[model samples]
Target: MTILNSQHILKNLQELKSFWQDFLPHLNDRCILLMSGDVGAGKTTSVQMIAGELGMRDVQSPSFAIHLRYENAEGKAMDHLDLYRLKDDDDLESSGFWDLFAQKNSLIIIEWANRLDFDYLPLNWQRIEVRFEKLSDTERKITTRQV
Candidate 1:
């Protein structure tokens, strides 16, 4: 199910906030948000904005840590992952990527999700794939769909 397919100029915070408003309704617990985009394409920024909207503060890119867990005021968990450094399934295993699925209530958000193989995902899991395309220095084309 394609939930959002739109483009926006993300040059300022207001534009990003507007985009978050449009994207927030489709988000839910116990789902995986797979994001793919070139470096500096706003994938992590989008996550930060969404996390802020969810009452989370100081959300940072998990690029160095590979994975980071956050909790909102309501105790909802969101797992942020960056797969750019992972090379293979062994690395994923070592990073505890698979274990995240066991957390039924956490929202898993993966950056560099193009590196992940979809076949390994549980069939019953709800997955949302979001793709970001850099149109210009301040614009991005964001497409999202449930898969």
Candidate 2:
């Protein structure tokens, strides 16, 4: 397994785009990107930025819909999921969350992933930990880790 712990400070959207560009080549269809952090830690923002960089325009939070799928700039399928409302495994099962894995060529990004039990998650997936550090009233830092 590749244990990666990389950090980047994103002060603006341009920096976020550059970071995604650098990380794009490392992503693949079988990867599930689990994002964990406190509320307002830029998890959705990160997803939106990555989606935008990958050519998904009009990206919005999937908190209400819980799941969304789109084609990236390369025409690759991308899945965005939110687990904030899931209360248990039965909820997940009923929601057909696991069914998403059946779809090929999916690069899934999940928000509020910390709410789920990690042991039940698919193995060999990438876990990204995002932490928002307040530097000032107008400035903040987005730290990311890949494991």
Q: How many pairs of residues collide in each model? A: 0, 0
Return the lDDT, model 1, position 43. 91
User: What's the C-alpha lDDT at position 31 in model 1?
Assistant: 82
Kindly list the per-residue Cα lDDT of model 2 for residues 30-125, writing each as its tens digit. 777777666666678778878877778888877877888888667877788888877777877776678877775678888877776666666655
In model 1, the clashing pairs are: none
The models' CA-based lDDT, in order, is 0.82, 0.70
Per-residue lDDT for 1-147 in model 1, tens only?
334544445665578678887777776667888899898788999899889888999899887889999998789888999998887788788888888888767778999999987778876677888888887887777777777
Could you say which candidate leads in TM-score? 1
lDDT of 1 at 99: 88
Task: State in Å the error of residue 18, model 2.
Answer: 1.6
Clashing pairs in 2: none
Q: Candidate 2: TM-score?
A: 0.79
- Model 2 residue runs over 4 Å out of place are 1-4, 124-140
